[model samples]
Target: MNEQDDDRDGGCGAGCGCGTPGREQFVSISRPSDAPSTAGAGATDRHTIEQAVIPAGTFVMGDSSGDRNAGDGEVPLHEVTLGSFSIDATSVTNDDFARFVDATGYATEAETFGFSAVFHLALAAPEEDILGQPPGTPWWFGVKGADWRHPGGRNSSLAGLGDHPVVHVSWNDVQAYCDWAGRRLPTEAEWEYAARGGLDQKKYPWGDEEPDAGGTWRANIWQGGFPGTNTLEDGYLTTAPVRTFEPNGYGLWQPIGNVWEWCADWFDPNYYRASPAANPTGPIRGGSRILRGGSYLCHISYCNRYRNSARSQNTPDSSMGNAGFRTVSR
Candidate 1:
């Protein structure tokens, strides 16, 4: 077995509580050589992507619930106004990505790098195919042959996951998909506003109620214990179907949990301090890009970032099993 070190670009912010202090929400190795850029490759098929129109309006942005993790930059409780825009009804599914792949032949960064970070409990590949775990994040393992197609590991397949959100994709990879789909990632401000589901300053997309309110699971997340027991109380160990949960008032599905959705802005913890009042796109430049919504691995004990105003980020080239993206109308 070839043991690999966690050669990452930087440490994770304090937002995602993934057990390890200051570790990234997902592990990312060194980036491979760049693949040919594929922007503006084709026009978007409206039939393939269902969109929900978020009417133009202004709303207070950031963590109003006061449940924000320290240093997550989800504060200052600033006001933000955004123009009318349309967002994906659900995250990009495996079937959708497969169609994009079949049409573009574009290689994702994970495929280019030959591996991706997989949750240790969800490992499906043989022991021989296991690469190594990061230094502090024992819950995650760097598995060879892990990509969007093989989310669990080398032995996993997309047999019944056609409707599930595609995992193991990077910000850079989403750009290629956008080029082929003729869509762009939502700005951080836009993502927050739409995720609010027309509600103002609520803790979740469904108001202040907890995800497990009334013993009903509103989102897919770790149920039992972090990194050890899941109990599958939410009926999912890795990822649930993109459209499994009830849609928000805006008709957006599972905007707060499922998988981390990439946004079209560079991540800056202090961006909210000086964010523009209208359509604030994040920083002009930064090394890490913003990621919104939590993933299936999120738990109250470990990662409780599955809130409306919750935020996280990773390098543009990073890819992991708990991350994917949805697109906005260009």
Candidate 2:
């Protein structure tokens, strides 16, 4: 990556993959525990996660559309072959996480850190719970008591959000969830392959058509002015239910938009230049982990990465309201 590219990546922290800014002021330096928990041994029994079984296939990976982010290493589109795998039909929901937490007694990194990134407009806690905002991005605030349960802050609860994809989960937290559920995050290549949904290099899972084709919204994305005014044209100001949109050919729902989903790969913009054609996992080591599928905050003017081949990265321990993850069978 070039100097300017480095600056752009640094500007947006954990949540910026979906347009939510990161908290640079309060960096989460300490890593969370990765030990597997014996609890939740019957997690599969409690929640029968619907998974889409993608047959082994080869498809071009990376962006062919001109919408690719500059310097995001989405260039030099290459063919990738992946083996058959089963992935959750939708992003992990609040109910799923709640079961894991209740069984394992696990505390997400955000809960351990005592604060997490929350969009300014979505702030639901008392003024005292508001910590501060990052330097460049004023729309994000570091709010205390903001985790998966209290997504909007201390006052927020998962009362009506049981089906919504769980937010405020860090990459490390996902590890715990996977450990309990006996699953793993999909590789970036696997994610893109399934996200394509049998289509070849299409801009979206459905097609190259715009998200709002013929005045009908396909995915949940920012409909109006970003950060300032959201007209709610897409029927939601924030995240919609995990299964809100139409399923792709592979029966995956909302693969491109709604919330940024975590991937099992360390990011390297230049890795694609030398990536193996068959089942390429990211780099051997890197500071940040991969985040795919931009969220509702995405707009064409800013962070328009809500596409099949778009990519973003953040530190493993950072958590925010617009990011979550789905899992593949181990």
Candidate 3:
């Protein structure tokens, strides 16, 4: 089957809860703590985000959810012990990225490439003006002038989204931010460990409960429909405020869904079989880097990596409106 830009691993309208590929939902997100968080603190001459400390420990990593929705890459459940470390309470935000750009006069990969892929619905252009959509994925279009600053298109702006996680950022772009911020992206193991929020074998940060068990929309995801229509049942059409959701057990915010977060390791689907018992950094070298958590684009009809342990990847230079990252420190 030819790959389409928006084509998911499964065709449209698929659902999974038993570790199979599908969709799930939740309630109005609220911050659990009003205490000033240490998530974004920095270490002088570099930007620092308040971070939550994840103590050193071992947890069952990889797929054991028995989730019929899970993919082959997440299989072969294994134990992974990770050292305690601190991670940003949430993914890096627009204001955060703006600071990086302003301090270094940096240009993002989208700017360098002169274009990036955009969700078709986010576009307001005449149909003919769309550069193109990748084969098979008709929902994604090549929209010019769609960078981090102008996420939707040329007409979009960052005026009120300073607190939103920065998108249209590639893995390469995140590396630069880490360098300047004096922090590093979480290793794949660390990311999963942190995201689990001290839970053992749960599909989401909050446990096995369905994402939308109550009347509330827990994470920001496509509600009513996938590509064609977003019912906004979650009260957001795109990114939600990074601090919108309650913290996981470890005081980290919104670990399961929002924007896909970049990890430091290169991606390898079968790496788990040979991965280290402790602190696996991923493949020594690979074509793409890992992205964890799902984005607003995820839905039951398509991708559902929003669950814990579900993962995706992109080339080091690939940037998209749904991509972002967070940081961890030694």
Best candidate (score: lDDT): 2
lDDT of 2 by residue, 1-330 (tens): 112222233223344525545545555445445633445334555546798999999998887776677556786778888999999999999998998888778888788778899888789999988778776676888898998999999889999999999999988899878877878899999999999999988999999999999988999988777678888888988889988969999999999888999999999888888889899999999988889999988888666788898888888878899999999987
Ten-residue stretch with the least lDDT total in model 1:
1-10
Residues 210-231 of candidate 3: C-alpha lDDT, one tens digit per residue: 7788887678877876668788
Query: Which pairs of residues have clashing backbones in candidate 2?
Result: none
In candidate 3, what residue range of length 10 has the lowest lDDT sum?
18-27
* Per-residue error (Å), model 2, residue 249: 0.6
- Report model 1's TM-score to 2 decimal places: 0.91
Score candidate 2 by lDDT.
0.83
- TM-score for candidate 3: 0.85
C-alpha RMSD for every candidate: 7.0, 3.7, 9.9
